[model samples]
Target chain A: MKLMVSVKRVVDYNVRIQVKPDGSGVVTDGVKMSMNPFDEIAMEEALRIKEAGNAEEIIAVTIGEQKAQEQLRTALAMGADRAIHVEVDEDIQPLTAARVLKALADKEQPGMVLLGKQAIDDDQGQTGQMLAALWDRPQATFASKVDLDGQKAKVTREVDAGLETIEVDLPAVVTTDLRLNEPRYVKLPDIMKAKKKPIDTTSLADLGVEAAPGLKVTNTAPPPERQGGKKVESVDELVSELKNRGLI
Target chain B: MAKVLLIADHDGENLNPTTPKAVACAADFSPEALDVAVFVSGDNGVADQAAKLDGVSRVLRIDNPANEHCLAAMLAPQIVKMAADYTHVLVAGSTFGKDLMARVAALLGVLQVSDIMKVESDYVFQRPIYAGNAITTVEAPSDQVLCGTVRAASYQAAGEGNSASVEDISVDAELPDHTRFVSVETHKSDRPDLQTAPRVVSGGRGVGSGENFDIIYKLADKINAGVGASRAAVDAGYVPNDMQVGQTGKIIAPELYIAVGISGAIQHWAGIKDAGTIVAINKDEEAPIFEVADLGLVADLFDAVPELEQKLG
Candidate 1:
């Protein structure tokens, strides 16, 4: 079985994002970029599945500018067999990204396509489900645990109320949540080996997928800030204040 | 004329509060007609409950065995089948909404406006990106039907007053057997649900252990508040992940939020930033949680929680 894991290059999780002054967008110039944290978990799950002899040949794919190949290299170092970079210099929305992935899925015909539930950059958790819908396949999203059996995958999903277990047939789309698994650290030796791994680059035009029309960002702004109140003297004072405010 | 179709989120027995909040968002734009689609396995009263929400015009219930569990695979096609009569489709931004709406959008060949924090116009919205670090105003194309997931925490629930009529509508779409619901494991807690609770009391790593969370629960019970935990506490195995409140967890907007021993991370702040009044109790005076807290108390949680509980009693 083959596993295709999708990753994205985004502003580092630790960086405090700032909107551009002119309302163009968030400041990304010279910002630290890394593979989305959840995608790392997805890649880690794929590697574990292969290590358990449940699958073979993990293909790491990304849709971004040339710099995104850096994340694909990181995926290669983390145990992906090869990489596919859909070279698009423009910012791709979820719909366009799903179209690109669907094109690749048609070419690869992998048994399962894995992705992060949402990108830390956009925080729009849509691409995986969109891909499943376009491809007319099953989707198991927000998965914390994924077990692959013969032509079936039983997934434990993280939901609002609690955990929900579902069974989906093969050739499905699975999105990873935070508690799925902690990603493995890329070793120095593996990094050097990844340098020699082959990456197949393609463009949206070549794949017969035009960038889909989507939402237009009109402006960007900082969220409203909360003003801090004075500290209370003690727990007694806190209770008194709560009562005074009719909050208790 | 925008005919809006809002999807109702429920537990097969009761309508989730998120549904009414989504209704409020839909009502904000003042669409020509706001109809709700309730998909259930049988004669669940969810449809009737949805009919009572103020501003709801009609309740369209789709009864099917495949809808016993909200599987996105089965629900998306049915929604798309009924898409022709509506100009917009809306759902709550819970796990269920985020999981299901995108598939519906894809099937309709349109892009989705996720987590709509503000509805500026019929076709424009403002949503948080970079995990609430920035907000972006976006304009969806008006030529096609719009799909959106409402941030329930950002709006008030639609009050129950008008008794809209309910209609049983069957969708002629093929339901797939590829996805099957197995089981769900929910915490059997009588405490108010964290998402809809008027008050929430959350603990952090400083709470020490899972056993120590009992005090946090006791304090919450005093005020009839819901119990939550920081990602740190959840990661430390002090509580279940479902109790987690952070960027990756439940975003709630209660009347009041009490943070105990939580040195707030940016991600955690994203979840509670919409809260009305925030109170922080931490031993470290410089904890970041205090920066946003309306009231701060620097004290050991072990000592302060017990003292506060006694005082409230």
Candidate 2:
């Protein structure tokens, strides 16, 4: 069985994002970029599943500009057997991205599809579920634990109430949450090997997928700043302050 | 006028408090009709509770044995079948909504507008991106059914007064067997829910171990506040993931937020940025949590928390 993982290029989690002054969008020029943290977790899980002898090949795919290949190469360095880069210069919303992944799923016919629960950039955690709906397959999202058996996978999802365990048949979609697995760092030898691995470049048209009409961003702005107050001297003073404000 | 269908979030027995918050957001647009769909396994009382929410025009009960687990795959097909009568579909941006709504939207051939914080108009809204660091205003085409998840932190729960009519509705959709419910492990707490609680007290890595969290809980019990933990604390196994408060965890907006021993990472700040009267108790004076704190106390949490709890009494 083959595992297909979807990785996305997003702003580094450590970087402080700033909205463009003109209210158009965020400033992404000259900023550090990295594979979405959750996607890294997904890739790590896929690699572990293969290492456990539950699966064989791992293919990492991304949809973005040419620079997105940097992320795909990072995935290759991490242990994906190969990579696919779908070149889309414009911003691809979740619906269009899911459509592209569905097309690839049809062509690759992987036994399982893996993705980050949500991209930290767009913050829209819709792609994986949308792909499952489009592909007419089961989806186990926000998965923290995955136990793969013959023709079946039991997934432990991190939900608001607590952990929920669900069983889905193979050829399904599983989205990774934060507690899934810690991603391994890329080694120098792996980086060199990844450069030699093939990356199949294609376009949305080549995949028979078109960008769907979607929500249009009208304005962008920074969140309202919170003001800091003076430090209190003691717990007594804090209690008194709370009392004075009717907060206690 | 826009016709809206709000999906109620519930366990098999009771309605989630966040469902009313979504109703509050959907009511903001003043839709011609605001109907709630309660998908449950049996004749659960959730639909009756949804009917009491102010501004709800009606409650549609979808009873099926397959809905016992609230699997998105099963609910999506049923929701799509009933979505033909409404112009917009909304749900609370809880884990349930985040897991379910996209599938419903995709089945309806539309893009979901996630985390709608402000409804600018029927078709326009504002949402946070980059983990609430930036807010973007977006517009959906009026031609298609608008699907969105209301950010629970951004709206209050609608009041319980009006009793809307309840209607039993059946959806003719094929439920898939590929997905099966196994079992769930939920932390049953008697304390106020973290999401809708008026006052919240959260601990961080500085809280030490799970046993050490007793002080945090004691302090919270004194104030009758809900308890939460930072991602670091949850990741360290000091608390359950459901109690996590951060960008990836539960976003909360309480009247008062007390952070004990929390250094306050950006992701954690995203959850509480909307909170009122923020207070931080960390020995690390340079902790980022103090920057946003309305009141800062540079002291050890172990000592300060106990003293504060005693004095509050």
Candidate 3:
């Protein structure tokens, strides 16, 4: 069996994102970029699948600029056999990203496809499921545990209540949540070996998939600020303020 | 007139209270104006839920017990074929909405303009990214299936729409043949639904321990507010990560958000950015939570909480 993991290059989760002066998008201004944290977990899950002798091959694919190759390399350094880079201009939308992945997956046709439950950059949480729709396969999003028994696979997803289990045959999609697994760092030796690992790069045009211009993001702005309250010293003072605010 | 198919919420076998919410969005962008139809997938008893939504011209109740489809891929094709007579389709943006819209749109070779908070003259949508740090408004190109996910909290769930006996639409049983849902595990909480709770009392790193969360819970029950936690709080083991609200956690937009002992981090703030009125209690006046808070209380939460509890009593 083969394993497919989807990775993405995004702004580091720690940095405070600042919007451009023109209100177009976040200004990367001197900020470092890295693999999306959720994708790291997905890649970790794939590597685990490979380690358990369940997968004969591990492949990682990414949709972003050329810098994303570094992310694919990170996956290779960790434990992937090869990488595929879908080179695109800046500002790729969620649907476009899905189209690109679908086109690539159609050619690869791996038995199991895994990706992060949602990318922190967009948080759209649509691409994996959308790709499954295009591929006409079963999709289990926000998976916590994935069990494969021959051709049939059982996926446990994290929900508000607890966990929901679904069964899907092979050649299906399962997206990983935060609790799925802890991603490992590449050792210096593996990083050196990753430099020699083969990486395949392609474009949306190469896949012969014409992406319909859907969901054009106009502008992005931060939400309103949350204001704070007063420090009442005693119960009497608290009541007085509550009464004044008509919150009683 | 071209029909617009709307997926209404089905409560049990009936439509969900949010079905009208879906129809309102559908009617807004319906090509035929008011020529909208709704479909509820359940037993025959589910038809009344579809009939209750306002402005629904027709309703379709599909009952096929053997037609077991769980994932969006399975259900999308069903909705797509049902929507063949219609040019537009709308559903409230919930977990299922995200899946259904993405799948339905992909099957039709179109991508949905998703996470729409408000719908105006055109099918304008506002979606957040990088968590709530950024919001983007988008317009989708014209397609046979115009799809959008309406935020469950953004609209008033209207009721008392036109009553109708929906015709049973016969869908080929072969549509959703691929997927199987073996079982579901739900996170049972004694508290209110986190998203819909009007008054949400959240804790942060200041609380110190998971046992300290009981205080927040006590206050939540005292005021009937939902219990939420910052990623900092959840990460510190003060609460479950599921209760976290931020760029990495759930997005909460409530009427009154009472933040206690939380030294506001941007990640935590991003989650609660939509709260209408925010009241933060922290000893540090310099805490960022005060920057956006409606009321800033700089004091020891341990002392303040007991005082407030005493006053309420």
Residue range B53-113, candidate 3, lDDT tens digits: 5667766656555434335655677777766676667777655566567777777776676
lDDT of 2 by residue, B123-232 (tens): 99999999899999999999999989999899988999989999998899998999999999998898998988999999999999999999999999999999999999
Of 1 and 3, the candidate ahead on TM-score is 1
Note the clash tally of each candidate: 0, 0, 26
Per-residue alpha-carbon lDDT of model 3 for A1-248, expressed as tens digits? 88889998888998888877677778886789888888899889888887887888888999878788989989999889999998887667666777787777778878888988778877777788778887878888888788888887888877644576888887888888877887998899999999999999888888886655756667777665433445445546655765677665
TM-score of predicted chain A against the true chain A, for each candidate: 0.99, 0.99, 0.93
* Alpha-carbon lDDT of model 2: 0.94
Q: Candidate 2, after superposition: displacement of residue B249 in Å?
A: 1.5
Relative to the unseen true structure, what is the C-alpha lDDT of residue B239 in candidate 3, on a scale of 0 to 100? 78
Tell me each candidate's TM-score. 0.99, 0.99, 0.90
Off by over 4 Å in 3: A222-248, B1-3, B9-24, B27-47, B66-70, B159-167
Go through the candidates in order and give each one's C-alpha lDDT: 0.94, 0.94, 0.73
Ten residues in sequence with the least summed lDDT for candidate 3 chain B: B33-42
Q: Any runs in candidate 1 off by more than 4 Å, and if so which? A: none
DockQ computed for model 2 against the true two-chain complex using alpha carbons: 0.88
Give the number of the best model, judged by DockQ. 1
TM-score for candidate 3, residues paired by index: 0.90
